[model samples]
Target: MTTQQLIDQIKIKKSFLTIGLDVDLEKIPHHLLTLEDPIFEFNKAIIDATHDLAVSYKPNTAFYEAYGIKGWMSLQKTIQYINLNYPEIFTIADAKRGDIGNTSSMYAKAFFEDLNFDSLTVAPYMGKDSVEPFLRFNNKHTIMLALTSNEGAFDFQTLNVSSASGSKELYKQVVETSQTWENSENLMYVVGATKAEYFAEIRKIIPDSFLLVPGVGTQGGSLSEVCKQGMNANVGLLINSSRAIIYASNGTDFAQKARIEALKMQQEMEEIMNLRFNV
Candidate 1:
């Protein structure tokens, strides 16, 4: 989906919530295991239940990769189901992939062409050559990692670096340097909600670019603080809540419980939109 189309969905739904389909077989309802493809069945139920409450769904690739071929098949079926049933809801393949240029191109094709995800999470450690291949795709997005929510982020992202302009933090350089690459307009970013204070400075660098923010419920990132600092004129944020929503219950009513959790976030997002944008 194009950026405008994603923005339109946010407006229409009065929400910018991205529900993470990071399914764990161990945590899912026991009854679902009876199905031939338990992962897909679990995802289908969650998607069906919360599709209306969320504008996006992100399935972290690691969850699927763990189960090997069957896991991959489940992922394919899940993306297919979303595309066929709810084309308007943006799909993100949370692969966090980055490699040499040729390898990156293949990864891009896998998600953008074969699987047909609207976006993919990409690591920027390899620099422009690795990430630009993903950005080259038209109407698709490459969400580069910036200041993350993990404690380890302090190890590098926050390190001070001297540049041609002046001294700047590493994460700031990542945000600034990325804009100079080809087709950078198609770029979004992964800014963890735990670093809410950084959103203000991050926005000054790329105010219009969308941010896919995780670390919300389970990680204790405050929704109000993230919205207060990160929201732009277009409400440029996709606050993702994974475990807290999808694993709300492991009982037969898991889907319903997931919907309830998503609804709570959606309602908060609607209120923020109304107060901030008057939508």
Candidate 2:
């Protein structure tokens, strides 16, 4: 999907919410295991229940990778279901893969072409060469990890690095440098909601770029705080809530509960967009 298409969905749905599909075998309802593809079944119900309330669905690739071939097949089934039913809703393969140039291109093809994901998460630790191949795909987004919500982010993301402007924060350097490699049109950064305060400064560097923000619900990142700091004229944020939404209940009512949680977030996001952009 193009950036405009994504933003249009957010507007049409009155939501910037992206539901994360981090399905755990042990966490799903016991009854679902009877199905041939429990992971895909869980995902299907979640999508059927909450697809209208959400603008995107992000399936973290590690969850499927852990289960090997069967898990991968489940993920494929889930993607096919989404593409067939809700083509306009953005799909992200949260694979966070980054490698040498040739390998990166293959990874890009795997997610963008074969699996048909609209975007994929990419790590920027290896620098431009590792990330640019993913960006090369037409209209597909490369979500580069920036100031993450993870606890270990402090280990390096904040380290002061000297530049012409004196000491610059590491993440600021990454965002600035990456912007030089590719403009915001096809590039989005993963700015976690736990690092909400940093969004203000990051916005100064690239105000219009969309941010695929995780950590909103289960990770305790405040939705209001993130929108307050990160929202731009274009409503440039995709705040994800995973366990809190997907596993709202371990019972058969899980799908409805997920929709309830998603609606609450989407309603708030609609109000935020209105107050920030249309007001």
- lDDT agreement with native, every candidate: 0.95, 0.90
**How large is the C-alpha RMSD of every model relative to the true structure?**
0.7, 1.2
lDDT of 1 by residue, 141-243 (tens): 9999998999999999999989886899999999999999999999999999998999999999999999999999899899999999999999999999999
Clashing pairs in 1: none
Model 2 clash count equals 0
Q: What overall lDDT, based on C-alpha atoms, would model 2 receive against the true structure?
A: 0.90
Runs with alpha carbons beyond 4 Å of true place in candidate 1: none
Residue-by-residue lDDT tens digits, candidate 2, 1-279: 889998888889889989999999999999999999999999999999999999899999999999999999999999999999999989999999999999999999999999999999998889988888888888899898889999989999989998875689898888888887853457899998987889999999989999999888778799889989998877899988899999999999999999899989888887888778765
Go through the candidates in order and give the clash count of each: 0, 0
Model 1 weakest 10-residue run by lDDT: 270-279
TM-score of 1: 0.99
Give the worst 10-residue stretch by lDDT in candidate 2.
177-186
- Residue pairs with colliding backbones in model 2 are none
